[model samples]
Target: MPTLKINDVEVKVEPGTLLLDACAQAGFPVPSYCYHPTLTPVATCRMCVVEIKGQPKLATSCTTLAADGQEVFTESPAVKDGRAGVMEFLLINHPLDCPICDQAGECKLQDYSYQYGQDDSRMVEPKRRYRYEDLGAKIVIDKNRCIHCTRCVRFTKEISGTYELTVANRGSNLEVTTYAGRSMDENPLAGNVVDLCPVGALTSRDFRFNKRVWYLKPVPTINRHSPMANPMWADVDKNRVWRFRPRPQGTQVSTHYMFDEERLAWHRYDLDPAVRVATPVLRGAPASVEAVAAALREGATAVVGQGTFGCDSAQRLGDLASAPELRYGSGDRVVQIQFPALQLSSDGVLNRRGFSERGYRFGHLDELLAKVKGGEVRSVILLHDEAFSSRAEAAKLREIVEAAPFSLVLEPIPGELSGLATATLPVTTFLEEADFVIDHEGVLKRYQKALQAPKGVKTVAAWAKELAAATQAAHA
Candidate 1:
């Protein structure tokens, strides 16, 4: 451990901690652009300059390390003046596109300018300019607004390991661009550069000019499609999901960024309420939960739960099984991921560990099918999501559902198995319900409900409880 004095206040930090981080921990965060916690710190921005007691000149806090008994002043007169000078240089060639810029409300450049920048510019020369260019279908670059912080460049090299972005030219002509104007479409994590940029220079093509970010309320949630179960935000407005952004956690570099697949997966959950299955259907007609429950309780029931769902849903689904051994698991889809640092497992079933902990056995759906066909398990109840299940797994599940004398299917969206189900219940999507799951690391991650389910839609847990009550009443 090392002790330092920030603004005359005593602070202790772990060895080799950056002065920038120490100042932040001491309650005086310095402004920075090129200093991302997860990325390599180049200290090129010069906005985080601070005065040290024994140093002749102000030092860039980002590149400087805290030492024992070091006296650091984050808001000294010289440091403030140095930061203002840096802001002046950064804004010299920057454009005045704030009104039309998508980053207007949340831009770091705008915030730092007001705090440390001079009231007016001293430049007599015209501002440098370059027309906005499309990097690919996923990203757009506005060179005119770039401050050459190189955070995006470092992200591509260090984090994504896809060196698709680089700085071209030098000095005033320096610009961040793809190699020989190559497309970024091949980079799966290309969308993250937009998040890395401190200014409006980089933006996502899918979210460009869609809606002002301030208007969209960010709801904390997890990436259900990701095996890491990465925390993310569902930016919603008017009951519709507009976009998804990575919700970074403390010291977990993997949480700082997300894959483009998970970023764009919000569209699947932003389903149209009008077209969604709104009510319980029994043999093609609207029915009550009691009717569906009675039909499932007709004989010995075998349960199949997809591990993509939350643990609470798994626990409720397991309660429907006639015996513990009758509980089967599903969701065997595998995804290909390039960045190993961002994701450890490629298993598409994010909650497999959670379901397994709840007594659901995976990789044995074939046995359940045989039991159903042999008349040993007279009824079957399946909780499935077609997106995360392989064709073979889905087909096996379909055979079990088809073989059972009576079947009940619970799905947020109807799939192939829904057609053969003796009864069906419309369930809330993951976004419409709050629940938690245990990941491959045995870490419990919770996600809150982001959207309200349609009038007749209910969560799997809610439906399961109702069905259990109905079964008990019948016996009573």
Candidate 2:
């Protein structure tokens, strides 16, 4: 460790750490545009300029390493002036399209401008313009807003290992683009570039023009799309999920960015207002939750709890079965992701590890089916989400649940099996519940409420606990 003074506050940092990172670790946030942790630092963006004791020129703090006895001034007048000058350069060609751009509220450029930029610009020439171009189905590139930081280019080279994006031409004509006739749709990690861009240069087509960034309330959540249960930002507004962004833990190692599929999974929960199940139903007719729970308690002799649910939901679903051993595990959607030390999961059901920890057995659906056929298990209760299960697995699940004499399906959103179920209890989606998920590695990542469950719907665990108490009272 080497001791360095940042803005006069002395701090020790591990060797080889970037000066900007060391400053950030010491509670001094260095403004940076080209310095993503996962990308190679080209020091193209001069946003992180800092004054050193002996250097005549302000060096880029992001690529600079601190040495013993180094005195760095992160907020000196000289450093401030340099940063302001860099901000001016960045805005020279940037289109003032914040009103229409998706990254307005969350854009680093927008924040840094107010903090370190001038209110008026000196540019008298006609502002540069470039038409918005689709890089692929997943990403849209706005060349005019780009600051030529090369963060996207570095990302494709260093993180994705694709090296697809490159700076073509020189100076004002330099543009980040994929090879001729190539599309980013082939890159599973393409969505990450959009996140890497500090400005509105890169935008997600799925998220663009849908919602303003400020209107979204961020909830720290885990990605259900990965086996590792990667931490993520669940941005919601007015009880609807608007987008998902990577919220990397300091050392969790799931990349500084999330895969495209994980980013897009937010769309699946787009509550279809017309199709959204509003109330608990008993054999397709509207019914009270109490009535549905009571009917479920009487009918279900076994349960297959989907592992896509949170730990709390798993516990309650396990309790719904006739016995603990009768509780089976579900959800077998596997996604094959091969990235460099990131996106660590093939199994899409992130909470499966948590559910299994609670005594639910996987690959044992046959045991439940045999029990149901032998008349030992007459009824079944299911907590399910069709998206987390593959078509083949869903077919198998439908077979097992339907095999029971009385099938009670609990779904947040109405599904195909809702019609087959003798009783259907509407349950809350993951966003509606305030719970935590333990990843495969036993990391208990807690997430807050992003959206409110529709009227007449409650969390899986709440419904189960209430039913269990009611059943016990009836028995007593």
Candidate 3:
């Protein structure tokens, strides 16, 4: 370990740790634009320049390694002057479009300018301008707002390995663009460039001009679209989710980025309130949850739980079955992608490990179907999300539901399976429920409720507890 002083505060760090990181660890975060931990550090943006006591000139902290007993000053007069100069040069050709820029509230340039830049620009020359260019259906690039950080270009080349983006031209005319006429639409991880951009240059077409970032409150959540169940933020406003952003775990490269499919999955949670199941139903007619639970208690019961849900919910749903062996798991829809570095697993079920740990057996739905056909199980409760199930798995579940003497389906949204059940109950979507899942790597990740569920819509655990109470009361 190397001991160093940042702003006169002594700190020790591992060998090879950048001064930028050492400063941050010492509670003095050096402003940096092109220094993402997962990406190779390029000292293009000189915002993190700091004064070292022994060095002749202020050094870029991002590229300078910490040394034992070294004295570094992050807030020194010389460091401040360097940062101000860098800020001035960066803003020279940048457009003053913060009012309409999507990255307004969270932009690094906006933050650094406020902290280190001069109030007025010295350059009276006209700022460079170019019309926004669509980088396929996913991304839009505005050249004027770019600071030439090359974060986006580096992300494509080093992380995605697509090599579609490059720095075109030199000096005053330099801009990030695709090769020749190639579009970034083919890249599964294209949307990540928007997150990597320190300025308003790269933007997501799906989220562009939709909502201001200041109004969106970020809620910590996990992406269910991938088996990795990657951590993310669900930016919600007025009880609706606006977008999903990658919430990278510290120093974990695997969690630093997410696929475009997972980023766009926020739309699935922004379902129409009118189309959601608001109350429990009995025989196709609206009824109380207690009524449905009482009806479900009359015969030998089994449960079919999809592994895409939380562990607590899965455990409670599993308890509704007559015996330990009666609980079965579903959801085997795996998505195959070209990148193994990005895609951790082909298993689409995010919480299969959680459900399995709770004693729910996978690939045994057919056995449950056999039991239902043979009269061993008379009542069945299915906890499911249609999005995670395939057509064939759904069809097989439908067969089991139709064959059972009594069936209850718990779903967040109304679907065909709900229509076939003897009783149906409204359940909270993942966005409206707080639960934890053991991901494919056997790491436990928790997601919190981002949006409010419709009135009378409860989580699976809540409904199962109520149902179990109702069943007990009927038996009593």
Q: List model 2 lDDT by residue over 1-476, tens digit each.
A: 89989988999999988899888988989998887776667798889999999999999988888888899988999999998999998888788888888888889999999999999999888887765556878888888888888988887777777877888888667787778747798898888888888898888888879888888899887777767777788998877898888897675557367888778888877786656776767766887666765665654378888887888888877887777888888888887768748856677788888889988888888878888888888778888888888888788778876877778898876788777888887788777888877776777878777788777678888888877887787788
lDDT of 1 by residue, 36-118 (tens): 99988898888889999999999988999999999999888898889889999999998888999989899999999998888
TM-score per model over all chains = 0.97, 0.94, 0.97
Instruction: List CA RMSD, all candidates.
Output: 1.3, 2.0, 1.3
Model 3 scores worst on lDDT over the 10 consecutive residues at 126-135
Candidate 2's C-alpha runs over 4 A off are 130-133, 251-255, 288-300
- Residues 261-368 of candidate 3 have per-residue lDDT tens digits of 888988888988877768888997889878887777777899999999999999899889989998899998888866777787899999999999988999998899
* Selected candidate, larger lDDT, 2 vs 3: 3
- Residue-level lDDT for 292 in candidate 2: 61
Q: Which run of 10 residues does model 1 get worst, by summed lDDT?
A: 127-136
